[model samples]
Target chain A: MSYLTLSITLIFVIIPLILSKTFKLGLERDTIIAAVRSIIQLLAVGYVLQFVFNAENAVYIVLMLLLMIGAATQNARKKGASIKGITWKLIVTFLFIEILTQSILLGLDITPPTAQYVIPISGMVIGNSMVLGILFLNRFTAEMETRQNQTELILSLGGTPKQAVHTQLITSIKASTIPTIESQKTIGLVQLPGMMSGQIIAGADPVQAVLFQLLILFLLLTTAVTTSIMLGYLSYPTLFNQRMQFLRESLIRE
Target chain B: MTKAAIEFKDVDYTANGIHILKRITGFFPKGKITTLVGPSGAGKSSLFKLCNGLQTANSGQIYINNKLIEQYAPTVLRRTVGIALQEATMINGSVEKNLALPLTLKGEKLHKELAIELLKVVGLKESYMSRNTQELSGGQRQKLSIARTLVNKPQVLLLDEITSYLTVYPSRTSKN
Candidate 1:
C-alpha cells in the first residue's frame, strides 16, 4: 500500500475520535494517543523487522526474540506484579513458548528456518502467552481475594498451602482459558481470523492461508493452557511461606 | 491445673494502623470447653486465627500443645486445632466430599461410615451426605463445616459463632 492509502486508514481512527467527541465519552485523548502510539510502534517494528530479515544473522534473530520477550514480559508483568519474581516468570514463560513453538516448527520443517517465518510466529506465540498470563493472573488474584476465607478454612483444617489454593488456582486457570477455547470452537464459522484474511488478501492461496492459520490456532491453544498452568504452579508456591502459611501480605494488591 | 491445648503470650496484631489485638495473653485448656465471647471486631476471631497459625502475630508467641506455634508445621498445627467460622465456606461438592476434605488432603481413605457418623454427630442426616452443599441451608452448611473439621479429629476445636445459623445447637460437641 502507498503512503497515501495508509494515511487514508487514519479515517478509521477519525471515525472513532469523532464518535467519542459526539458522545462525550472522554476518550478523545486516549483514542488519539493510542492511534499515534500504534502507528509509531508498528512502523518502527516494520523497519526493524525489515533490517533483521535482510541481515539474516542468527544473532539478530536472537536479539529480536529477546526484544519480543522483554516487551511481552513488561506488558504482562503489571497484572501479576504482586507475584514474587513475576517479571522473570513472564520472561521465562514467553521465552519458553517461543522456543517450544519454534523448536517444533523448525525441527519438523513445518516452517522454514528463516527470520520471516520465526519472527512473526514468535510474535504470535509470545504475544498469546503474555495475554494468557495477564488473564490468568488477573483471574487468579481475584480468586485469591474472593476465596480468601475458603482458602483459610482449608488451611485451618490441616490442609497444605497447595491444597488450600488448589480450587482457586484451578478455577483461575480454567476461567482464563475459556475465552481462547471458546473462540477456537467457532474460529472460521463465526469470524474470519485476521491472520488468515491478511494472508489471503496478500494473494496467498486460500488453502495455504487456512493451513497456516490452523497452525497458529493450535499454537495459541497450547499457549493458552500451558501459560496458565505454568504461571499457576510458579505463582502459588510463592503466595505462601516455608511454614505453609498463606502469605496474605504478598497477595495484597498494590 | 488442666493442660493448655493452645496458649498465647503477649500477642499483638495491628491492621491498617489500628490495634486489633495488643499484648493479648491467654490459654484454652485441653479436654475442656472454651467460649470466646466478644462483640463484633473484638479480635476474637483474630485470636483463633493466631492459634491455628492462620495469621502471624506482629509481636507475640503462640503455642500448640506446649510447643511454639512457629515450631509446628502450619498444617500439623491446624489439623490439631480445627476451627469452624460463622460463615461456613463449603467446597463445591457433595456433603460427603466436604466432610472428607482433610482426609483427601492426607491421602487417607474416607470410610462411608465415618462420614455418616460425623454428619450424625453434627446433627445432620445420612441423606444430607449426598446433598449438594449449595442446596444446604445456613445451619446445615455450618454443621457440614464442623463435621469436616471433626473428620480430622483435632484435639482442640475453635468454634467461631458456630451456632449462629443452627436451629438447634449440636450440644453433643460440648458434651464430648
Candidate 2:
C-alpha cells in the first residue's frame, strides 16, 4: 500500500474514534485502550501468522483456529452474563460455520487447505462470524429480556415462540448481515477490500484477485447469515419458557 | 369468576439445588389485575415464571385452563400468556417495523393504521411511528412496549416492575 493509502486508512479509523469522543459516547480513555489493544493484538497475530503460513503445518493451523474460537466463546459468555451451558451455544455456532465453509472450499479444490489457505481464511471467517454472532446473541437476549411482556403477549395471543420473538430475531439477524450487504454494494467503487489488496500486493493478477475477493465475500455473507440465524434460534429459547414468558432467571445476571 | 387462568399446585422450584419456591398452591383468576407482591428474593418472580410456563415445578403441577402447563406447547402457552418485564428494549429498526412484528410473523398485513393508532393510544403521536425505537426515552419506550403487547389483546399480561419507568399518573394509567 502507498503512504497515501495508509494515511487515508489511519485517518478513517482515527476520525471515528475522535468523533465518538467528541460526541461524548465514551471517554478518551476508552479510545486509547481500544487503539492500543487493536494495535498490539494485530501486530502479534501478524507475526505469529507469518510463521504459521510459511510452516504450512495443518495441526498448527487447527490449533490456532481453536484458540480463536475459544477466545471468542469466552467473550460471548462474559457478555451474556455467564449463564451455564451458554458457551457451548457460541462454540457450536462458530465451529459449525467455520468447519462447514472450510470443508466446502477444500472439497471444491478452491484452495489447498494448507496453512496459507487455512490461517488467513479461517481467521477472517472465524473473527468476522464471531463478531456477528456476539452482536446477534447479545442484542437478541437483551431484546427478549426487555420486551418479555410483549413477547409473552404475542404467545398468549396465540402466537408461537418463534412468532413472539420474531422481531428481535429478525433484528439480530439483520444487524449481522447489513455490513456485509453494504460492503457488497460498494465493492470496488468505494474501496478494494483487504483480501483483494493482499492478493494484489503478493503479485497476483488484479482480475483474479477481484474474483477471489468476491468468493471470500460471498462466503462471509453466507457464514454470517447462517450463523446468526442458527444462533438466534438456539439462544432465544433459553430466554423464554414453554408457557411463553421470559424466564426471570434467564433475564437476571448469574 | 371464570375458570382460573392459571393454577399453581404444590409447586416446588429449585435452581442450582436452591429451592426458590416451595410447595406453593395458588389460583390466578382470569381478567383482573393481580400483582404478585413480596419482599426481595421471596420468589414472587419465580412464581410468575411458573404461571407463564417459563419454569417447571420440580415436584408439582401447574395448570393453565385446567391443562397441565408442562403438557402445553411453549408457542401455544406464549400466545396465551402475554408477559413484560422492567427492562423495555427497543429493537434495531423503525417503530413501524417493531409494531408489525406479530402480524408479520403470522404473514398478516402490516396494519399501518392500527400501528399508528396504538402509538397514539400509548400517548405517542403518529410521528414516532417512523422513529427509531432506540432513540425514545425510557417512559416512551415502556409505553410503546405496553402498546406492543396490547396489539394482539393477550388473555393474561405478566408485568414485572414495568411501572418503574413511568410517572405516577402513567403508572396508574398503565394498570387501567
Top candidate (TM-score):
1
DockQ of each: 0.73, 0.28
| lDDT at position A7, candidate 2 | 52
Instruction: Count clashing pairs, candidate 2.
Output: 14
Please write out the lDDT profile of model 2 over residues A1-254, one tens digit for every residue. Answer: 55477556766567878888789877567767887798689879988888888887778788899998999888777765433467888899889988899989999999886887777788788877777877776677677677776665555445666777787788778877888778788888978899899889999999999888888898888888987898877777776554455555766665
Query: Stretches of candidate 2 above 4 Å error?
Result: A1-43, A79-84, A242-244, B1-176
Lowest lDDT sum, 10 consecutive residues, model 2 chain A, at A239-248
Q: Model 1 misses residue A216 by how many Å?
A: 1.4
Judge candidate 1 at residue B101 and give its lDDT: 85
| CAPRI category for model 1 | medium
